[model samples]
Target chain A: MSNLERIAKLSGFSKATVSRVLNHSPHVSQETRATILQIMKELDYVPNRNAISLSTGQTLQIGMITSSINEIMLPFLNGFVEVAEQHGFQTIIYTTNDDTSKERQAFEDLRQKRVDALVIISCVTSAKEVESYCKYGPIVSWQRMDNPAIGSVAMDQFKGYTLALDHLIPKGHTRIANALGRTYSINTRSRQQAYEQAMQKYNLPVLRQFYYPSTYTILDGERVMRAMLQQSEALPSAILCSNDHVAAGVLCEARRQHLRVPGDLAIVGFDDTELSHTLGITTIRNPIAAQAQNAFHLLSGPLRGIDMPQAELCFELIERTTT
Target chain B: MSNLERIAKLSGFSKATVSRVLNHSPHVSQETRATILQIMKELDYVPNRNAISLSTGQTLQIGMITSSINEIMLPFLNGFVEVAEQHGFQTIIYTTNDDTSKERQAFEDLRQKRVDALVIISCVTSAKEVESYCKYGPIVSWQRMDNPAIGSVAMDQFKGYTLALDHLIPKGHTRIANALGRTYSINTRSRQQAYEQAMQKYNLPVLRQFYYPSTYTILDGERVMRAMLQQSEALPSAILCSNDHVAAGVLCEARRQHLRVPGDLAIVGFDDTELSHTLGITTIRNPIAAQAQNAFHLLSGPLRGIDMPQAELCFELIERTTT
Candidate 1:
């Protein structure tokens, strides 16, 4: 016989009565419940969480759907998990690698009640398809979403770019260049647009030769910087990089080529990571931890029937000697 | 009514028969099974994984207990998750921050049947305590365990140190120093022993002043290097850093102080991460991905009744300009 059946037979109660006692239904009398609990302890009948979830309808899990994992995503994940663990929830990360079908499967996990809520760090899926699942559970994203029900908490990438450019232009730099990450991402697009607009504002020509599409690694920075140095055209007065790693690469390559930083080419990097601090690279401080915290609160607040205000987090610029 | 009862009513079958069909029991007639499946589809009846897990005793999930999340842990996690996903299993990571109680709770999660197997990256708990839970499920770790049931797949830290020291000694360096991460870790202890052994083998004295206990970040490297520079004793002719980040920091600080690398201070780094590639820091290639893969295969093969050999992975020395 199963543990439940054994408990029922030993306590002189039906299996349903034993289950009711296990679930704390309160319909069972105090004396009968005490006897059932005693028998359960003697039998070492530890209640399975699966059965408990079936009765309670709460998995106590929060699902996170991320496109990729890297150094940039580390702090954000750490912050989100910190808040989640405080509220007695575990975060299940599903890395989809920007595949729409895999992202849809993650949403299906939400529909199946494997998790109480879902947080989309990044995705390739349409906002409307994502919105359809909001009714099933609370959904939040780091990107801006059209649906009012879906929580949108994100950093102002455009402002981050403008801040870096503003810092450079005042230092007598007119022929400036920009090296960014994948063009497909929303953050990259925003920064690229800002770069163009800021150049237009200063009446500086936007040189096509100066643009470099770089990846997030330090080697990508070195590759792009090498290409820039090899070109016949005079190097741009300054360059804006995607992140500190890429900037560190740019600095290393420039040193290799015997080019003086700020004397020959002024460089600005984004995401004031630890590398930036070590190398004294001036960078824009992306508010990753704050954005992650906001995303979590947006997910949990609504479940408690508390209204959360939709807001965009801001970025800041940290000045160092490299600029 | 629950979806199960609704499907039964629509198919004119008993609830138990519908459940048997859902559970894929061969006792159900083929026609009846087809009809019940059709009814389930029509009603949009999605079987809950929780209920299915209770019946099948398979959660299709793997539990990972890691001490913390940092740059060092990222690749190991990526490798493990990739293999786990390919095998149709999801990995649930529990960051214990080396907290003994929290690590025990993760083990308890296994005993409660939440995960089919457990992979321990690092923990503060004793081996015997960890081994007791092996009978509950498949267990694997990056550290060596006394129990035969637990899988041990780890890199040879002693050999890694000896490789670095031997490489440096051939270059005519006697005043060599070493900087490492948390001293309490087994990896650190092993490396320290190897450093002492290699120094004695060379008939050189191990100076206490030259030993630095540094963390994983580049900033720690800078701090230790700064302290070394200010000391009354002459700086070591060469330094062996625990990892690339610290090595990178030492190089940066040396440059700031106008000390030429390999001229004033030669350096060797461990964990040939992306940073090492960018800065051309000679390092020991810690095979993290291969170790993660071995750990997963060890866990899965045993569950299939396939005996896996207990093995220790080796590290390699990457030649670069820093040395």
Candidate 2:
């Protein structure tokens, strides 16, 4: 006999009743469902997930579209995956490598019903294009969106950047150099604006010689410091980095040059990674864990009886030895 | 008209011809398939992946079951995801957190045809239990297994450990202490064995006081050093760590205590992560990227006209400032 028939015979329930329990239908009582599941477990019955997915229209899977898996993205991904697993949902990741075509393909996969929902991290595609897929499934993004139909849980990067500058400027640091990563990204633009606005508020000049454009890495951070030292203009008393890796890099290079931190060249970094805590680099806590949890909850809102338009998590300054 | 009918009308082909192209049938000529696909793209037709999966009995999705998303797993996961995406396959990740039941469920998911293949990274389940699922679909593992039915791509941890010891012992270091991570794991056991064997080969006594049991983190490294300092025994001249993070932590604590590196205390670390490079710690290269690529290829071997029983990648020693 088939596994379903065997389960029906053992549980004293009809085949249809056992099938309902397997599909997780609400029509069956909890007690009766438990009994049937126990028998199925005893029989070592493994239900076909694809068949159930087709019937219930629930894949029990969450898809995430990311630019790349690097130092900055790892923590966020880890947090997101933890939350997803706790909720009994598997995560399917599509790394687009910042390619618009790949991003579109990821959205297309969602439309094809591969996953129940999608959370996009650092998207390169336009908002309008992304918004079009909301009809297919719930779509969430790391960037804040104007449309109420889409869900977003973004960290206030502008506030975070200002928090860094605010900490440095009070220590009589007017000539603060800055490191920006990926000039085209919205996050980077907001951070740049924050630096400019904070400088203007304090009546400080935003000089070209102080600008360092490098991606997130310790090597990048070291390269920025090297470039600064080689420049003909006088070095800034303080440098604000894009992330902890860059900050750590700056600290390494500064140490090599016998520059005393906070005395000769103060450093401030974003994303309080493990590197920051280990090396004691003062940085802004990006709240990546909270963002991941909030994003997952927002995407799974309908199922969990939760309703919210958007969530803007706050970033806090973590003081350490560097500053 | 339906998507298939629309594509058929636009491409001047019958509905069955377009359907064959959509399902990726071997009967369809490449030239014909290309023409139909172009027309479907022009019309913005997205054939349902679930429907195709049902008919073809292929999900075109690879499932990975891992313990957790930590420092070591991140690189492997990223590498695997990149390779899978290049082959037009989506990756579904199941973070079991070393839970045997969850590991079983991951295999059951494979048995139920949710994925075409599965990769088990750091499994807690017994080989027999894992081998049972091979009949359902292909299952690859990170750890080396004696069973030929199961596919495996493992790095020789024994050689990796010896590589570290050989590099250190040559510099007239006899009193070498070791820090081990995850004592329960086979990899850790192999590393411990290698250390003991190397010590025996050099006619050096393996002191119990020098053995530090700590996991893979910079914090753990610092704690080990602190614990050692509090003990009555004199500190060993050189120490070996499980990974770069631990090495970095030891360095930090050593510096805090004003101990001179390579003079007062020589250090060696494994996994040559970014921390090792930035801090100039000598370490053994783990070759995580190569392991990932080889594992994926081994799992997808049947499809690519490649047949291999197993693959064992080697590790190399990288000399840095600390040694």
Candidate 3:
């Protein structure tokens, strides 16, 4: 016999009564509930929670899609998860490694399982394509992309990069180089736009040789710096890195070559992570916590067809010793 | 009329035929199915996937429990998620931050959603406590802990540390001090055992002054080294750090103080992560991909009641410029 049937037979109750007791229904009488609970323990029967949830018609689950779990992604996720938990909902994170098809597959899978909403982080999928998935549930993007169908909690990368350039320009530095890591990333593009705009405003020469590709972590930063040192005739007086990890690398390489930071080469980085603080590198503070909390609010929603708000978060320029 | 009823009326069929078409049943004729599909699109009705999944009785999903997503945890998760995706299962990771009650809540929540299994990484919960939860579904640990009910894919930290010591011992180093990151971590405890055991065997003093607490990231490593430099009467000839991040800091700090690696202070680290390679720090290779693949296999199984074999992964010491 199945567990429910056995419980029903032993408790001298119908399947529904036994199920109600198992579900902790207040409708069940005290004596019978006590007897049923005893029988459950004695039989070593753990009730089928899956069946109960399906019958109740509430999953209380939200789905998140991320490109990768790294220093950059994980902190935002932690903030997302924290807010999700506070709302009495559990988050299910799906990684796609920036593959559009894999991201679509994850979306289909989560939809099939009936997640309340989807939080997509830095996906390359078009707004029109994402709108189709909006029918499944509410979709929120981590990066701010203006889509009628999607809500986004975005940090102003343009303003952030502009602030970094402003910091270096005041320090009496010209011939500044910008290393916007990952040529294809939207973030890289946005930061690059700001860099070009800022340099053009000041009439500072933008050197193509100094622009490094695929730089993310400390290792990537070190590799880029090493390559620049080898390839370039003369290194720029100051370098604007995409993130703190790259800035840390530039600082390390400077240490190796007996060059003083801000004296020999001024460097300003994005994302004021712990590494940036340790190395005393000047960087922009990414509003990770704010983005996550706001995204959660937009996601755990009245499921679709509301005027989605555009939340453009402010960025801060944290100056210490690097610049 | 409801979506199914509207489709049936428009397609000149009964509600049962439209329901069959919706479910993709083989019994439905192709002509009728095509007709019903056309009507479904015309109606612009998004079917409730929850009802469909309930009727089908299968949800190809798994759950992973993690304390935190950091440098150590993120790589392991990437490996786990990679294998799960290959097996046509999507992973929903729950971050507990090492809180037992939070971990318990996540277990209950995932079980309710009927995840295929649970993969826990370095949880503080006891074997017996976790084994009890195994009645709901198969529970596998990411860290190797010997328990009949729980299957684990654990790296031999004792063996890993021993290998590091053996390498340094052969290099003619007697005054070898150790730095165990996280004073109370199980991995720290296990690695400490090997460190002490090796020192005892070699008739070397186990100095308390050399040991530092909570040294994980590069910043933490730098702080510990600085503290040692300030507090210690005489620095040890060699230092065995917990991980590569810590080792990198020691190397950076060594440069700061004009002390060369291996020449002034030889350093050995654990986890042959990419940062270790960049700095050329001699460290132990953590079999991240291997461990993740094995853990997933253990979790996504024909549930309980079979002899779950223990998967003890081996460790390797990578020699580099640091030591």
Candidate 4:
């Protein structure tokens, strides 16, 4: 006989009562529940997950959607896995490649597969598309989201940029340049706003040619630096980059051009990545691990009725050899 | 009634016949199958994965075990996801952190969950532990494994080291030093063998003091370089590093000490990571993507019953300004 049947027989109770005890339903009496639990332990009985899921109408699986499983997103994913495992839920990962159609398909597929919840990292979907899914189950965004239907766990990008700019402006950098990432990215927009405000506050000249729109890559940083170096006009005393990966590229290109860092030009970058430690690059340290942890908490904890949790992680400005 | 019931009623057939048709079972007749398929499309009936899994006793999931999900391992994981998705299988990642206990626990858990197969990116367990796990299911190792129980897919590390040394030795460097990774790493052993053989072939004196065993990090590389620079003895004309990240640090430290590349000291690194591309460092290019793809294929395909696929990916010597 199965463990459920044995528990029913030993306790002289119905299978439904045994199931109630196993599921911790409040309807069962405390005395009888304790007696049934004792019998279950004596028989070395283990509950069957298939039956439990069938009764509760829930699947014990969570979904994680990432733009791409590359270097830029590995640290976030590492934290996600660790937290998900502790919550006794297996994660089903879907890589959408930042394509809208693919993201929709992935969401539809995961929903069809009956995942209990979703944790989206860098969602590329529109507000309406995300809202339609929010009605179905718990959904948490690892990065900032435009839709209120999704709960977000992200760092304050505007603050991070302000810290970087504040560090540079106070260091006697009257003419400063900025290397911005893609305009479509929400984080980039926040950083761009901070750069603009900080420049205006410091009363520094903002050159149109100095502000470059590039992708979040070292090669893009190199291209922007090369463009700056080739200009016939006066060069900026310092440069502020979107992230450390791009900053590393700028440093490499500058060295290649036989320019001494902090001697020829001071530089600041966001995201104190491992490269920053090796290169001694001054940068803003975004709390990525903390953001990931908070995202996991929002995904795994009890669902709130209406208001979603919006937590902003702290940022730090690290001074190093670059600036 | 479910959508399957509607399709069966419309086709005037039993539910089993409809399910067989939907599952693409060989027992169905061609005419009836075609009619039922057309009816399914007309009715918009989708097969339930739970029912399919129950009928076929297949999970439709593959397990992946890796050392860590850092920048170095991101490309491999990306390639694995791309290939695994094509075969209609989801890849579940488990990180071992290069610990034997964690590796064993992950293997046992995956086995209990009944994953279709396993693909290990690096060795986290001893040969005996891996061999024991191989008894239950198909296990493929992306990194080289000496045991016959697991299939291996790895880049040609020995040849890569030889290529780097060949480029350097021909440049008239007699007193060459080596910056190796952790002594316990298999790749380190292979590269060290190649370096030793190359020095012997050229009849150059190999000094024990010239070799440094450090972890695979830029800071570790810098520390090793600083230690070497402080030594009273004469330094080697060139230094060969285990990986590009390490080589970048070596370059930074050399620059800090007022040394010149290809003038004061020539440098070469391995793996040709993104840092290598941005910095234009001379190194060996390993086929990381191809190796990942092959490992996924071995895990998801029919290679479980046969001996493991022991194939070596090709490597190339990329000449850059660093050398």
Among all windows of 10 consecutive residues in model 3 chain A, the one with the lowest summed lDDT is A301-310
Residue A239 in candidate 3, Cα distance off native in Å: 2.4
TM-score-superior candidate, 1 or 3: 1
Reference-based lDDT, residue B190, model 3: 88
Q: For candidate 4, give the lDDT of residue B264.
A: 85
In candidate 4, what are the lDDT values of residues A1-323, reduced to their tens digit? 87788789889999999988775455789899899979977775545544565776655567788777755666778877776654435566778777675566556655664577788886678867887887677788876776777877766689888888888888888888888875677877898788788878878777667888865788888887899988888878899887888898889889888899998888888778778877899998877777777877776554322232545568999999989
- After the best TM-score superposition of candidate 3, give how far the Cα of residue B42 lies from its true spot, in angstroms: 23
DockQ-better candidate, 1 vs 2: 2
Candidate with best lDDT: 2
C-alpha DockQ for predicted model 3: 0.28
lDDT of 1 by residue, B108-128 (tens): 878887888999887878888
Candidate 4: C-alpha RMSD after superposition: 7.2
Tell me the spans in candidate 2 whose CA falls farther than 4 Å from its real position: A1-48, A51-55, A306-312, B1-48, B51-55, B304-313
RMSD in order of candidates: 8.4, 4.2, 8.8, 7.2
- Of the two candidates 1 and 4, the one with more favorable DockQ, higher being better, is 1
Question: What is the alpha-carbon lDDT for the whole of candidate 2?
Answer: 0.82
Tens digits of per-residue lDDT for model 3 on B33-53? 788878776675555545545
User: What DockQ do you compute for every candidate structure?
Assistant: 0.30, 0.51, 0.28, 0.30
Best by DockQ: 2
**How high is the TM-score of chain B in model 3?**
0.79
The parts of candidate 4 lying over 4 Å away from their true place are A1-62, A86-92, A105-116, A135-137, A146-149, A170-177, A200-211, A228-238, A258-265, A303-312, B1-57, B135-137, B174-176, B205-211, B230-234, B303-312
Off by over 4 Å in 3: A1-57, A109-113, A182-185, A230-233, A250-265, A300-313, B1-58, B109-113, B170-176, B181-186, B229-233, B249-264, B299-313
